[model samples]
Target: MNEQLVLRVLGMDCAACEQRLAYAVRRVEGVRYAVADHGTGVLEVHLMPGTDREAVAARVVEAGFTVTGVETR
Candidate 1:
């Protein structure tokens, strides 16, 4: 039941931004892994079953970035 969450994030300007966001997202309770790519403005996350998507988005926002879109599969 694991889910893959694809997020479009804004305001990331460099590799440091990607690393910072990946760290923040991976700390969320249900996240298995997170990879942020500033070049494409995308954050890909693997989450445990039943993880709340809103909660994940909140964590990203808290990390000082904007989550412009979210796709779950």
Candidate 2:
């Protein structure tokens, strides 16, 4: 089983910030893939089933970004 999570991230002001956040999300245990877009402020993540959304949010926070919203697709 797998889940797709698209998060709208705020406070990313540069390409480095986007890359860092994408890298952080990928570092999460259940995340299979991640793409952080600075222009759109969105992070699309493909994750394993039973993954904790809070954990995902925490990883983004650890990278100094804020998750404003989450959407499933």
Name the TM-score of candidate 1.
Answer: 0.95
Candidate lDDT values, in order = 0.94, 0.90
lDDT of 1 by residue, 1-73 (tens): 7899999999999999999999999988999999999999999999999888888899999999999998987
Off by over 4 Å in 2: none
Where does the lowest 10-residue lDDT sum fall in candidate 1? 50-59
Question: What's the C-alpha lDDT at position 33 in model 1?
Answer: 91
Can you give the lDDT of residue 38 in candidate 1? Answer: 94
Q: What TM-score quantifies how close candidate 2 is to the native fold?
A: 0.91
Return the top candidate by lDDT: 1
The clash number for model 2 is: 0
